[model samples]
Target chain A: MFRQSLAVTLINLKSIPQRPGMSIATIISVALVVGVLLGFSAMANGFRATVQGTGSQDVAIFLRSGAQAELNSGLSRDEVRLIEEAPGLARDSGGEAIASAELYVIVDGTKRSSGTDANIPLRGVGEDAALLRQNFELVEGRMFAPGSNDLVVGRSVQREFSGFEMGEEIRLGNNNWQIVGVFSTGGTVFDSEIWADLGVIQNLYNRGSGVQTVRARLENPDAIERVRAYAENEPRLNLDVQAEQAYYASQAGATSDLIMYLGWPLSIAMAIGAFAGAWNTLYSSVDRRTREIATLRAIGFSGFPAFVGTMAEALMLSAIGGLVGAAAVYLLFNGVSASTLGGSFTQIVFSFAVTPSAIIAGIVMALVIGFLGGLVPAIRAARVPILAVHAD
Target chain B: MTEDLRQDTLYQLDHVSKSYTRGKERVDIFTDLTMQIGRGEFIAIMGPSGSGKTTILNLLGGIDRPSAGEIAFKGQRIDNLGQGKLATWRAHNVGFIFQFYNLMPTLTAIENVELPLLLLKMSGKERRRRAETALDIVGIADRAGHKPRQLSGGQQQRVAIARAIVADPAVLMCDEPTGDLDRESANSVLETLQLLNTELGKTIVMVTHDPAAASFAKKELHLDKGRFVEREALA
Candidate 1:
């Protein structure tokens, strides 16, 4: 039976080229489905990589109670001093704590592409920020001097927004700010923020002798519990404490979840549509070869061989569709940078990632469509009546 | 005449009844039909469209089962065999020819002939050898590489016959084998059948509407509605 079915399957595949009309349509439809599916999921994956995964557990973030975002959080001068002195914080070689009291504010910017006004995050941080964000590097020019009206712009902001070029100055909050340095944070969301000295921003914006958030390098990742307990026990400094990675992960969820929600259901629906097309194509294939199948039946080829033949043809066509889809996504979207609104309501630049797992997922989806689509038609092929050859 | 043929009975149909459920209609094609076919005999079943001529051939070849009858092929009851066992029975003992030639459109003439041999546990080289010899016997070997569409109606029927005989089956059942061909092509196909019956000593049962085509057979049985009404034998 195995040998016979193999022979029948070979014959079925060879015959497809003669009637390429419907089968080709099925292939194209399935390809488009997989392409769309992979493209959107890849975008979501890239979003997660940039916005959520770049943070480390060894660093902790503190936000005011009931505040989910740094932009909406605040720290009093006393609260800042208290958290900075809290135990379980990592120390630098100079015997000072590796912590930074930070302020996050959205500032106006001119988009490079359209010259339209867009809001970008401008973060004010202490000197320890350089140590806490391990991948931060000044790619061009010099770092901002303390107690000066100088700002270091993120690489993405410099590339995407105008007036942030090296040595350039832009007016913000009634002060002239010079773009002294351009820095990168290894493709993290921080790459989209402009950073300035904490004192300069605190004075210019009249932020009331406080910051929006405090970040500290933990003695170890597990020491987050000690920090959280300290914040909770100090009622005057009642703040939410979490690992930086967890903080970013919480910030990353809504957008990536929305994109993924759009991706999977849309993909599955399109798959169902492609499955319909495949059903029509394969059924017509069986119908058109009715007499041929009947003759094979009459010649003692069992129904199982016919069933096997039809099923093999369907899978081959679907696999071709899957490969085409994967290739399309890889070529058109992979590593191509784009930005979307993040948890902070600011553009977070990221590149689309067509990962191997995404490709495998798309291919498996195509195959599932093929399998469901082919089942009924293959059974019909198997039961094709031998009398059809004599119906003439 | 039927009793005389029973002396070398290759097929014996006793009280065969056949019907079909077509949509809401129950179509009765044959009732209590009895017949005998001799070994090496070439017989033609002549009838109108609904006369159940092809049904008899199908039953004898084990392509179908009798509704209520006993079909004996060389004294073995084949009508009672299950579908799988009947398929094996048909593979080893029967070959079929059909009106439209029914050659697999994708396969070449030689490949179509090699189809039945795929059921056997023979080597590929031997299968090719047997298919080649069958094509040669049908005089269509030169066009063996051509697909069904490339061949004329007569040539396709000849290829179909080659496919049938390649398995070395004892019986060849043809249903309107030359119905789609022109007169010259039909005559050519009939002559090939005659040669297969006489030279190869293979028993043949063919159903045809044309008397000219029936003249090639040793005995012609004319069926009307359900029963055999006339029997004629000619040299």
Candidate 2:
């Protein structure tokens, strides 16, 4: 039976080249469906990777008790100091806790790509900011000097925004700042922001001794719960505490969730259309090979082999389509840089990530469509009467 | 019947009936028909259209079942077998030849001949060797690499014949094998059937309207209105 199926399947596949129009129709429809699905999935994966990669499990964020994000949160100087002095905080080599009281502000900037004004984040960090963020690296030039009106821009911001190069001056509020250096944080959300001295931004924004969030590194990963308990119970702090990883995970949820909710149904709808196209192609193929199939049965070949042969033809076509679609996505979209307004109302830059898992998922989806498309046609082929050879 | 005669009998049909439901009416194609066929004999069933000649061939090959009574092939009741079992029975015991030379167009002559051998458990090399031998026997070995469309009608029929006999079945059921062929091609096919019957000891039952084609068979039976009206011994 296995041999019979293999022979019949090979014969059916060979006939596909003779019916190029029908075969190409199936392949192209499946490719379009898989391509669209992979494109949107890669977008969501890249957004999630950029946002989530910005956070670390050992770092904890402190915000106002009801604030949903650091953008809307404000902590006074005393409250920030109280949280930094908490027992579970990790100290640096100088016996000072590795923590930063940071201010997040959205400022208008001209996009290099569109030449239109968009909100870009300006993050003000204290002297210990670089010490606290272990992933931060100065890629070019030097860091901003204290109280010097000097600003360092993220690598992505330097590439995507106007007037963000070294030695260039940009105005924020009533003050002018010099872009002194460029830094990268491993393709994270911080790569989309501008960094400056804490006192310089506080004086410009008029927020006097108040910052948006306080971030601290814990002595160990397990110390996160201790800090959370301390913040919730300590009256002087009056703050909400969460792991930096969880905070960024929550920040990424809105966009990724929207992509998933919209992309999945769109993919399913496209898959249904592809399935119908495949069904029509396979049905026409079976209709044309009716006599051939009946002859096989008449010559002592069973219906099972005929059914398997038809299905194998469809699956083989679908697998090819899947590979083509995945390759198209990888070539056209993978690692392509893009930006969108994030939960902080600031433009976040990311690249489309066509990961290996995404390609595998696309191929599996194509096979599923193929299976659904081929089922009824294969059954029709199997049930074809041997007397059909006598019909015409 | 003598013991020697009983030993040679391949099929015994007893009071067999076949009917079809066309629209709202039941049409009887064969009613209360009984027949016997012996081994190593080439028999031709001749009849007009709708005389149940092809119906008998379909029943003999297990492609169709009788509506009533018994059909015994080598003393095993086959009329009551289920579809799957009947398919298996046909795969192992019967070969069929159609009038149109129904070879898979995508397969070459040797591949088409290897179709039936695939149902058996054998290595691909063994199947190919046997298929080549069958093509050799049918005298189309030189055209083994050509597809059905690449060959002439006579050569295609020879390939179909090789496909049928590759499995070495118990009987060859040919339903109007020469009906679609020219006179020369029909004679060529008839000569091949004669060789299979006389030289290879294969029992063949062919249905044909051509008297010349039927004359090649050792025994000829005329069916009319679901019954055999006459029998002739061809010399």
Candidate 3:
């Protein structure tokens, strides 16, 4: 039976060279479907990669007890001081605890190229904050000087946001802050923000005697649980402590879920269109060869063999379409950079990754559609009356 | 009782009945029909429209089961056999030819002939050899590689004959075998049928309205409204 099916498959493949247009159309339709599906999947992958890549095992994020993100809550200046001075906290070269009192605010700004106005995150970091992230590097100009009205713009911020260039001054609530330098963290979510002094941002936002969040590095990475326990027991602070990576994970959920959900409809609709195209081609092939099919049955081919042959033709067509679609996706969308919001209330930029997994999925989908579309037509062909075999 | 008469008795039908349902009415096509044929016999069934002559060939070829009674080939009952077994029995024993040459357009004459042999577990080369032999017997071996579209009506009928005999079945059944041919083509097909009957000793059952076509056969069975009204043997 398998051998018979293989012979039928080969025969169908031979027919493709003669009808090049139909073959090309099938391939193009499949490619379009696969390409769209992979596009959305890549966006999700990029967002997850950006956020999950950000935090280290040693760092932790401190927020208010009921707040999910920094934008929704604030930690008082006294709580920041107390958390920084807590035991088990890592100390820098100057013997001060390695912690940063970070302030976050959404500042309305104009985007570059299109100049569309959007809200961009403005992060205020303490002196030790830069040292806490090992990947952060100044790509151009110098770092922002502490105690001055100076700021450092991330590379993505400089590219996407208007007036966010090195040495340029951008106004934040009537206070003018100079963009002293441009920096990048290679990957990770920090590559999409404007960083200034914590006190400057707190005063500008009128959040006196408080910071939006307190982030600190542990002396021993495994002491995260003890730190969480300690923060939970502190009756005065009412702080929420979590691993920094987990915090970024929460940031990734919203955009990732959206992209994944978008892929569902896109994949389904494309599969239906491609399936219909395949069904049209395969049904015609069966109908056109009605006499041939009857002749075969009359010549002693069992109904099973005849049916299998017809379906093999459809599957071969679909497989070809799947390959074409995968190739198109790889060529057009792989390594494409895109930006969206993250769980930490910050913008993240990453590339459209056409992973091997996505390609396999597309092929599977194509084959299934082919099977569904081809099986019924094949059966119909096999069941045609023997007298009608010669009617043609 | 004689050896010659016994050898001539290749098939027998006893008390056969067949009918079709048309709306609320029962259209009786054949009833209490009885028949007997000899090996090496070239027999023609002649009848007008609705005479059930073709229905007799269909039943004898195992393509359709009778509504009642028995059809026997070589003294064994066949009408009541299960469908699966009937198919296997048909494969080894019967060859059917239609008025229009039903060769697969996609296949060459040789491949068309080779189709019946596919049911047998033979190598492709063996099937091709047998197909060639069948075409050669039908006197059109040179046209084996030509597709059906490339062949004349007579040549196409010859290819159909080749396909019918490729499996070396014992009985050959043809329905309006020369109905779609010109005078010359029809004569050619009739000659081939005569040769198959005389030289191969095949038990042939042919249905035709054309008396000229029937004349090629050694015997004539006359049917009317589903009954075998008369039988005539020609020397």
Candidate 4:
């Protein structure tokens, strides 16, 4: 049956070239609809990838429990020391626990000649921060000197926004930090930030109580439960313990949810337009082939079978268009960066991430459009009178 | 001769009146028309424009239900048959040869001939062989691979004839089968129709305005305002 249907589908496909306008119109409409679906899904996946890749599995982040975002969470110096000294933390080569006091601050800066003010995320980390994240690599110049007012801008920021060029000095609050190097964390959220010494940012911003959060590497990621229990039982200090990966995952919840909710309605609306285009194209096609359909009907083809043949033709055409649209999204939007407001009351620059999942979504959307649009016209074709058609 | 006509009735149209309504007006094309066609008989129905000549063909082919009265096919009353069943009935038992040949432009001559067989549960190879045999019978086997657009009018009409008989239907109905062809092409198409009637012992009913085209039929029925006025049998 598929072979017979395929033969008829090929005939329909061959007719497309003769009616180039109608065929191309349908293809482009479906392609654009599929492209939009792919785009949104890529953005959501990219946001998740960026945040998740920046965190380490063996590392743990300490933030106030019940706090929605890290920006709203605060800890004292004693709490930071207690987390650093906690057992189950991974030991470095010198037998000292691997830990870092980190600070996050949002600053407004003009983007070179454009002079458009944009919020830039500045993350202040301890000396062991770079060593903890294995994926982070310095592509140009060198890492910031310890205890100095030096900073490394993300590679994406350096290329897209001005003033992150090597040797250029950018003002961080009241002090100036020279952009000595640029680093890339492969398209993560970290690629859009500037990294500095934690002490300087705390002092510059008058945040004297402690760093925003304390991060510690665990001896074994599986031992996170024991570490969390220890942090909760510590009588002398106030602390909250969570796997670094889990914290980043939490940060992505709001954005991922937003994308998922928006995707359905947007795709459905666009699909209506695409389906209409497909219906119009298929209706005209069925009309042009009235006599052919009549012949098929007269030859013992059931109306339902003829309808199935038309739908098969539609499905084949939509699948082709879907692949094209997905490919277009990959080539044009993948890794493209833009910023949106974050839960931390700051701008988060993220890139569009293309994955296997996004392509599947696009193809499914195209098939739906084809199915909905082709059904009615196919039935109409099947119901046409055979002898009436011959008379025409 | 009269005894031969009494063998068995293949088609019975009893008081089959077809009326079409347009907006607020009721237009009756044929009122109380009665006719019968015998098996293995070649018949031609001729009339002036608006005389419901084609409407009678449509009724006989199960393409449309009459406004009133009975249309019996093979002794079965088909006047009130549902659309779905009518479709099945047409597919298994009726062959239609349309004016202009109406061969699918994208299909080759043999493919068009094999179209009817696609509805059957036959293997592709078997369908192809059958299509080849049909084209051979029509003497157009050499042009089996040629698309309708690639063939001349006469060749296309022959291909249409091949399609009609490929299904081995009980009745072959042609509506002005050679109306769109030139004189030479029309003669060829008429010859093909005559061959199908005489050589294959197939029942054929043709509707045409051309007197020469009507001459090839074994019998001719002249219709005036949906009434059969004259019935002639060729000697």
Backbone clashes, each candidate: 0, 0, 3, 0
How much lDDT does candidate 2 score? Answer: 0.89
**How far off is residue A100 in model 2, in Å?**
2.6
Per-prediction DockQ, in order? 0.73, 0.65, 0.30, 0.53
Superposed model 2: Cα runs more than 4 Å off:
A90-97, A109-117, A171-177, A219-226, B1-7, B231-235
Model 4 segments more than 4 A misplaced: A1-13, A91-97, A108-116, A135-142, A182-188, A230-238, A335-351, B1-4, B12-34, B66-89, B231-235
Sort all candidates by DockQ, best to worst.
Answer: 1, 2, 4, 3
The 10-residue segment of model 2 chain B with minimum total lDDT is: B1-10
* Tens-digit lDDT string for candidate 4 (B104-183): 78889998898788766788899999899989888899999999999998899889988988878889989999899999
TM-score of each: 0.94, 0.91, 0.86, 0.88
How high is each candidate's interface RMSD, in Å?
1.2, 1.1, 2.8, 2.5
Real contacts recovered, all predictions: 0.73, 0.73, 0.22, 0.67
DockQ of structure 4? 0.53
List the pairs of residues colliding in candidate 2.
Answer: none
Pairing residues by index, what is the TM-score of model 3?
0.86
Per-residue lDDT tens digits for candidate 3, residues B67-118, read 8879998898989887567767777888888888876666689977877776
Q: Considering only chain B, report the TM-score of model 2.
A: 0.96
lDDT of each: 0.89, 0.89, 0.79, 0.80
Give the CA lDDT, 0 to 100, for residue A372 in model 4. Answer: 84
Candidate 2's residue-wise lDDT over B13-132, tens digit each? Answer: 888999999999999998887777889879999999998899999999988888897999999999989887887888888888889888888998998999888788888899999999
Q: Model 3, stretches more than 4 Å misplaced? A: A1-35, A108-115, A147-151, A158-180, A269-290, A344-346, A378-382, A385-387, B1-8, B135-156, B177-190, B209-222, B228-235
